[model samples]
Target: MRTPLGGNNLTAQQYESYPSADDTWTVSFNNSAGTSGTYEVYAVCLPATQAP
Candidate 1:
């Protein structure tokens, strides 16, 4: 779980991981500093607890 938010123009980023046997988890992004921008992505899902 990584949350990095920047300001003075805004540049927020987040990353989460849960992949090895593959339970499906992948989120990639890249603008590479090309002009023209508009971005807002959010995902909050929590309901997974099993390991006893």
Candidate 2:
């Protein structure tokens, strides 16, 4: 947010996802309010390796 808006003019975001038990994930710039225009979400996961 830049200028910062009032409570009445609040902004929000949400998502639903089903990830693996070994999945690594993170979220950023979510459920925020203000006079801005920037939001992002990131997720990183590594698959299970097979036996040699």
Query: What TM-score does candidate 1 reach?
Result: 0.30
Q: Candidate 1: how many backbone clashes? A: 0
Misplaced by over 4 Å in model 1 are: 1-28
Candidate 2 segments exceeding 4 Å error: 1-10, 18-36, 49-52
How do the residues 1-52 of candidate 1 rate in per-residue lDDT, one tens digit apiece? 3333454343334444344343455555554444345665444657889999
* Candidate 1 lDDT trough over 10 residues, lowest sum: 1-10
Cα lDDT, all candidates: 0.48, 0.50
Per-model TM values vs. the true structure: 0.30, 0.28
List pairs with backbone clashes in candidate 2: none
lDDT of 2 by residue, 1-52 (tens): 2223455554655555445455544343445655454444556456679999
With a 3 Å backbone cut-off (N, CA, C), the pairs that clash in candidate 1 are none
